[model samples]
Target chain A: MKLDSRKLKILQAIINDYIMTAEPVGSRTVAKKYNLGISSATVRNEMSDLEEMGFLEQPHTSAGRIPSDKAYRLYVDKLMQVRSLSEQEAEYIKDLYESKIMQLEQVILNTAKVLSEMTNYTSIALAPQLSMVTIKHIQLVPVDKSLALLVVVTSSGILKDTLIHIPEGIDSDYLYKVSNILNAKFRGKTFAQIDIRDLSDIRNELAENQKFFNSLVDVLTTSFREAENREIYLGGTTNIFNFPEYQDIIRARSFLNLMEEKDLLYNILVNSRNGGVKVSIGTENPYEELRGCSIVTATYSLGDRVLGTIGVIGPTRMEYSRAVSIMDHMGKALSRYLTKLYGEQP
Target chain B: MKLDSRKLKILQAIINDYIMTAEPVGSRTVAKKYNLGISSATVRNEMSDLEEMGFLEQPHTSAGRIPSDKAYRLYVDKLMQVRSLSEQEAEYIKDLYESKIMQLEQVILNTAKVLSEMTNYTSIALAPQLSMVTIKHIQLVPVDKSLALLVVVTSSGILKDTLIHIPEGIDSDYLYKVSNILNAKFRGKTFAQIDIRDLSDIRNELAENQKFFNSLVDVLTTSFREAENREIYLGGTTNIFNFPEYQDIIRARSFLNLMEEKDLLYNILVNSRNGGVKVSIGTENPYEELRGCSIVTATYSLGDRVLGTIGVIGPTRMEYSRAVSIMDHMGKALSRYLTKLYGEQP
Candidate 1:
């Protein structure tokens, strides 16, 4: 119960073995496989003590011991050693980022792909939150005699466009002039500010075309208001099949179904509520469906402004040290790239 | 060994029963379940003839018959009945379309969701090809000190926006003026035209900001050039597990992997070539991994202008009649919506 260094070593041996083979670890196997300078009898006594302390459990009377969620929690929090990525893996990540990616959405998507491929687990990335970002410009373009396009740009380098119906007789030249007037008036305002600010001047300028001008402003306001809706990018979801725990069809279906629900995934990542790498082991996860899984999350940010979260989901016996290290590095890299993109701090 | 009338009826009963139950259909089962008014011996004789004609096969000597790819082809082309959807299913689709959806992307994504849910198979929708559509409008929005957003609207109701870095000291007013001038020159022009047209007039207009102007035009050109890059929307991929054929983990993984490859899916949809509901059953498919699968595709179009494709992928035992009917209906619905959107006939 005291969990002295000897007992701790026995627990570490059990967890490490279980993680590798996904099989229970017996004292005799631990004694034979590990150079712990201990006899099988001594290892057995220490294993009994660890089990009594609730860090390990036996599946059956004749079986070896498996690590309980408690043991994994302890390992992740205290006993685990972070391993550096292999030279090949580091080079792979380097090559992935070296490609000329022009958009932040692509960056986030590629991050999900690389993480899922490297870790061999499902990866989810939440796109940056854009609500507080200010609008830099708005443009209206004529599509035909009956419809036009509305385009909005935000300070943090996000682009959104929407189509709107326009009244007839609005020629391309006339729409161009209106686009200029609107952009000059609305530039550098946040969506929140635009929502509250008066655009009477522009409204009066286009008063003769009141119906078209009003609809244009309404569409722009709605686009800005809806900017915070985050897009969830998921990768390698079927890798769930490779894990023995999910080989059962029912369990696999539940896990796969959970990945498809974007709102639930977004909530899971957002609720981590941690600024740095945080490991949620087994039942520590908030959702009942995910209680059988382990989630490792890290927030990406620019200065103190948190952009979003990136996470990896795997069986409870995940490669935590490796996943945590990768996430930590990725968080920093994403933040650096975004900061460079915005050309600012915070 | 030609399939006579009785033999065709027997083959249809076996294939129908096998599709529904995923069990081998014997002569007795068909005689009892289908009320074919023939003795088991007579039914068995006809089944033997069908088998010799390459329309049925036996998995084992003691087992009954299952339809081969050849038989499914004949049945799809001739024998299958077009069953009307249930009232609840019709209502579900009507409700989905009745929602206040505005964007074409959202419509396609929602269509994928509804199709997968209704058919209980994985669905993929390829967005309309952008290259053939003329540029209807162009707007430039300011993002920040160093960034800007370019919004393009095409005649076919498609909107694409991109972010670009900007030089220091350019104002929103100037960008507006430049946007107006560009619209005067380039509006109603196709990307194909822009690619070939000389831009000396606009180049001279922004001669002081020639570097910025040239790069801006270059980015716009690149965006237009890459317009044909199709966007694939996938839904209900986990439904792959529902079919007995893909219950094998390896088979399911391969199917899921194929969906992740966008280019391959684009090719599959494009190579389908036909403008109506097309069913490729089992080994009839071109891709080796999908040889065990069936894909039902239908192209949605307005007049002579083909927009893109919508398809459902499932095991060879898929309910082809229902999927084909659904695709045919949904294809027409999509074409109607897109035509109303672009407000023109091809």
Candidate 2:
């Protein structure tokens, strides 16, 4: 099983064909469709060799052979030529940035829409990971006797504001004083680098307002964790129907049910967080609902910080070359738009 | 054929059985099961009359009869006694609000989840209408040379903060001064009540910074319009697979596709906004994708201000009595939680 060049070519052709038609690729079909200067006999011999080497499988005893996930992983890593996006798709991405300055959420959402529309697969865009973003400002504004507002602005212009309890009553001057102290400690530091355990000295300084101080720390900690478990925006969820594998009620049900569970999707996207486009095929995905699927993801950043991931999900027979190319370009486009949006590198 | 008690009872029995079994009802089966004190012969004759009156139809002449959308509408309007939610369902809702204070978005999302889980049907919850909520506080915080944060707090504790352009160099004191004037005009007024058309006199004072003022007003107007077109949360989208009608690929595709469309769902929910529970059945729906579905909605409010609608959508053979009761209670529970979250009666 040395995987000679002729055998590799046959395996590649079978995978490319299966990705298109979702059917097993027979030697005759491949030989007739692709001019590889080989007869059906030679193609059939190579196909058998490829199957023996674990790159192909016969779904039925007498049917044509389909490429395995191992084959796709091979193609994605080496053999496949990543095609550039069509003019229309590039325009959609260009227009999203050009149409006007969009909020960060809208920019991520539009990226999901473009990816899904361009490659008829379920697309996901995770929000920027605020834990990785440096805190630029912190303010505590007194709202009323029982509630106060905690506003934290990040370096890339992302804001997190929540109504926190002020059970001890609001001392406007005191709250502003605490906010100033917090600003001094937290500015230019990522939440991941800052910890409650490291701030015992500051805690002792606010011993009289311990309850309010605890609430303040809780809000910041919660925001940091929430960013780690950020929102997953999905587009073309129903596009799962386009594949023959998901036409079955049982299969579609499992996939759609998986969509309802955010923790699982969060983990899936988070695991795909490499600096560049990464492809996870079939059993490579740990989630059972995705055992029959493949995922292609790329990290999209804000400013110089890698924010989160954006991906395309489809049946294991995915158009990996195109999906990777699109994701790579989309991730770059979003980074540029976000950096430009926040006044060019903040 | 003027409807009589016996005919109405038979039609009700048929629709009830169809809702549970998703099968057409036969007169013999109805008489045997319902024990309606009528013979099969009597029930059969009444069924014929009901079909003639357009309350029931047969897919094939040889098969049993099924209830029409008109029959379900009638049942929803006059015949069905809205049963109270089960003890378990009541506890689920009570626990949601009682557990902890939740953000408004989370409150709406959890409501949809509980509704869908209780009824085993796809559920929808529209976000609270900010246009109906009066403004409580407004602030403009200067971020940098080119950006400012616009923070608007609604009376109901909803916060909308967006980054707006500061085209002119930041004069921190001037922005604060202008903010005071804007607050004097906007406080205690709903976005719907406050319009750019009424603020021309104030525009004169801001004529020197016309571009900045225009950006400020544009942000407000967009926020107002966006609140009118707020997010619609969905739960149990795969619940469509539970119905036999959506088992077919074409039917399920259309239903799931409709799930992705927020504007159509927005219109559907908005049209369903009455003072109480409203049921739109089958052909009564305007959207073609929903022709075979029924939507039951109830208006949930914050204090006395009507916020938005929460709804359940399923095949036309909807469990009307249970869904109506659940929605009625769920809407009230949400209203109570929201009012309480905003510190009550504000």
Candidate 3:
């Protein structure tokens, strides 16, 4: 009746075997494959108890039972060992930083790719939400007679460039004067910090150039609004084909579609931004598309500031111990690189 | 043995049936469905001749025949009708620009996505090679104590931002000095135009500052070399799942991996830069992975200057008429947007 040590041990064995083969585990197979010091009959009886306890499920077609998400959750939390990455693996994550004089975008993109290659799972690197980061500089470069490029550099190392159309009166000297005023006013203010009052202040200073002022506001407002949608770089999208779970073409297609839904992943990553690795297993996942999958996410931070996430997605029967360990290690590696890249004194 | 109108009609009917059903075409079905006027016996004889000519391939496991890439090419060039887009479709492409005060990157990306959705094939938008684009402006923003963000705006509406680390003894005032000198030399000149002479000229002007100069050279060289590898935006990768050709996981994985190889795409696009619309059929493709595929590409241009490519990839039994139509429309739409955004007198 109780989840005693022996029953828990049996549960662990079934989950482990299932994770390896992605097949329903029978008591006899577990008894033969694992030295659980139990007879087949005993193992079968314990599996029945585990099923009664809602730790396993028997599909309509298969006689053998598979460990439920509940079982995997318990395994990830208590049964499994969180093994730290070895010398070479840790070195690989660390080496990602030195291997290139990378921008923040490059680091996140490469790390996402390497994470997938190493773990053989779908990976995502969520780009940091940077609207709150102080503006470092803003420049306007004339591209054509009436078009210009507005380049914005943020202290968090995010750069955004938008195309702006100049009005009739805006000339080279006028552009320079406006840029100087923009630099003076926007140099250290975040987009969140700039408001209607700031717009009015700039408008009054250049009250005569109302058309150009409207264009500038439109560009700034658009960029800030766009910053709300955090871009996600996905890697090893095809790696899902390696898993038996994706053997069904329909299931594989749906999973691929899920990878394209950025809002779903953004929410999952955002909610977990408070700290270290968080594992959402199977039915524990909020999105219907992920109900059959498990997501392992680790937050990458700079000091107390949460930048983004490094994570992987695999079938519910995942290598939990290894995924968690690698995520934890890589999370630290990304944090270290970000600190070196954007954490220096401004 | 002589080529005739009836034989071509029968081939067209077979190809159309195969494309619609993604199944091997039998002569009886083609005759019945297409109302080809020929008897099943006559259609069968024509199909055999088509197979002998390498216009069709008979699978070892099936009695039916499928169109070969050569057949698709003949169909595209000689048989297929390059119908203009429906008013709604053309309107949809045009609406993409007005709906958002979009940047070039956004326009290219959305066009790739829409091209795939409309044609039900994988699509690509090759980012413009900007090394030859004339520099319009340059600005450097100090980030951390040592880190700075370098923003470069080009006349072709491309903005590149790179991170540079400042060495000791270089103040913000010194950066302003260096930026002014950089603007003088880099403005109105393409990266190709700024040779060793320009580098030494800058060096002579900033001879007092050597360490910072070295950092600048490293960043510039990296950016220029990186530009050579054209960034390709791919869409509807999972759309391959809709086709019977990718039903085999191995073939599907190889095709997906091919999509990841930017160099392969870069070469294909570059070679097509001198043309309007190009159709490379099956064995005609250079990459082995593309041997079973058909790629239809249309070049987008600004005036006589080639900007980039818009293309689609599908099975050898592709909807050539439709894919070709959508690509040509989107390419021109993109070209029109580019010209309006950047084509004004400088």
Candidate 4:
């Protein structure tokens, strides 16, 4: 919907006031509080026009007006001013990025915690998927008489290990030899590109060591299948309770319950994956339980491939402009940090 | 407070009705629905006394009564009857336990999902801690020219991996030699029992190889430190919304927010570490934000050491007796699973 400058100002004032107080905004209240150089009657007339255009709503005949979904859309798209991060917030982000995290899980968790703490909203960050990156190296180590450890390291620096059972009497020297051969052949190849049909030929070429080669291929296939699974991280879910909008105990419980569903959350974040920042306002989310909340999400990437998304969730009347900016900046910082960690310097 | 048989029956009826309907129970309705052999007037008189004893509460003068915190306690301790799991539920749990999981994370996630689906309540399961378990074996494999991978397999069959950086030109043969020496020295000891003072002596023995030894120790420390961090899995969070009690969006969101707090959840689960089932009714939980809900928790163990907790969360009027029984059974099952995996099979 088109919004003229005067009407835009009125809508912005209503939204800003409503967000702060969580109370309806009357024409008189907006006119007096904002000093908009207009009388209450004129402001009321403008509000009526805004309502007709689906930008405002009134709860009852005597109540003041509030911003509608359309109004929030307009404000987010056109009128809302992106606020710069406070000095403390910028320092927090910088410190987080500078910290030496030992694993990708720690990095994702700390990022979510920092974002949620800064925004005073629930935050979610998904770890970079292993499938997007090629396997850099594979190592097999004999753990016991009958078991060997399969360690796989990806180009993105994620380390995954699994235990595979080898028949008794297999010497560590033979295991090492097989590991070397597999690493030489499979290094730098993505799991998707590995051909299962080639295993028989590879095993036949192992001379008298065909048994060990068959076991090695089986272990590698299992590891790749397991690696395709995704890991997700969430932080600061407790921040949701502090919002006035969730004062009711039942509503608070429902939202918390929804967060526990991994499948639902994975779908929510993955499906909303547009390249840049995307805001899903109240009722815009797919789940009915989240109809009263808004999600501000941004997809972060390592190079051109999207790694994962970072998002903040709050009441529908949330500070959309600030949330959008925070997510956008954090997304870029995370992307750059990930790229650096993966040795993709440009 | 002590309750006579009639009062006990009345309390049980009220709790059962409230759990099923999530609405206040009136004396007349109880008299009509239950074959208590009592008139509505008599039931009302008993309910009034129950309220005076803090076992029930009336929202208003003319409204029906709801179970109070005192009432839930009585029901949990004495009145409520524990029911056996339905055939479907038993089969579901069996199927879940029988499935071949890809990793420890999958096992925990699937366990949480099974509990939540069976109970129709939110479930949280914490991962077993690795530090308490002794290392079965350790293996080091060369990943690239500058990096190596360490795979540590615990006695309980859990696999943890860490990336170790090797100084520029270290060869695979040198790494293999170091791995053998380190394993001989540190294989059976838990990380907490490792002596740093003696580690320095070992480093001195390495001399020209000191850098690699130091790097290996760094990798080991990082692996154990990461494993010590609690991993929580949550399921059926959205089920909270389906309850009539959480019809108000505000209340649902507040409780949902509380569940999202990692520290809060850790504290809640760990504080009740009596190695048995624990029921914390309304206002009994340490956090005020969780005052309106009830948490039923039980700690699972590998032999004598408490590894983690598994619990269900619901409203104060929840089916306490059944929840406690389920938790108790699940705790034993998990402990047995761990014992079997660790070679302590019965």
Error of 1 at A179 (Å): 7.0
Candidate 3, residue B231: how far the Cα is off, in Å: 0.8
For residues B1-346, what per-residue lDDT tens digits would candidate 3 score against the true structure? 7658888898898888888998889988988988978789989898889888888888864679988877787888899888888998888887876666456677788888888888889998788767646778786756557777687777666778888888866676777677888888788887667665677877887777787888898888787777654889999998998888788877887888899888898888888887688888888988787888889999887666777888999888787887788888788878887777676364
Residues B78-150, candidate 2: write the lDDT tens digits.
8888888889989988987886644778888888987898889999988888788888777777666777788
Per-residue CA lDDT of model 3 for A195-235, tens digit only, reads 75667778987788788788889988877677654799999
The total number of steric clashes, by the backbone 3 Å criterion, in model 1 comes to 1
Give the Cα lDDT of each candidate.
Answer: 0.81, 0.83, 0.82, 0.78
Top candidate, metric lDDT: 2
Q: Which window of ten consecutive residues has the lowest lDDT sum in model 3 chain B?
A: B96-105
Separate DockQ for every predicted complex: 0.61, 0.56, 0.57, 0.40
Better of 1 and 3 by lDDT: 3
Q: List the residue pairs that clash in candidate 3.
A: none
- Deviation in Å, model 2, residue B106 alpha carbon: 1.5
lDDT of 4 by residue, A1-346 (tens): 4667888889899999998888889989989999999999999999999999988889898999888877788789888989888788778888999987657777888999898988999998767766767778767777677777777787777776766767768887877777666677777777667777756666866657656666677667876685554566777776777877677766766677677666877887887676889998887778888888889998877777777888998888999988988898899888888777665322
Using DockQ as the measure, the top candidate is 1
The complex in candidate 1 yields a DockQ of 0.61
Task: Determine which window of 10 residues in candidate 2 chain B has minimal summed lDDT.
Answer: B337-346
Model 4: per-residue lDDT, tens digit, B93-172?
67776765536566767778878887788998877777777777776777677777777777666777666778877887
Tens digits of lDDT, candidate 2, A1-346: 6888888888888988999999888889989898899999999888888888888999997899998888888998889998998898888778867876446777788888878998899998888787878877787766567777888777778888888888755587787788778888888888787777756766877887788778877877777676664688998888898899888878888887787687888898887776888888998889767888999899988767788999989899988888888888988988877777763333
Query: Which portions of model 2 miss their true places by more than 4 Å?
Result: A144-146, A167-172, A197-211, A343-346, B167-171, B197-211, B343-346
lDDT-superior candidate, 2 or 3: 2
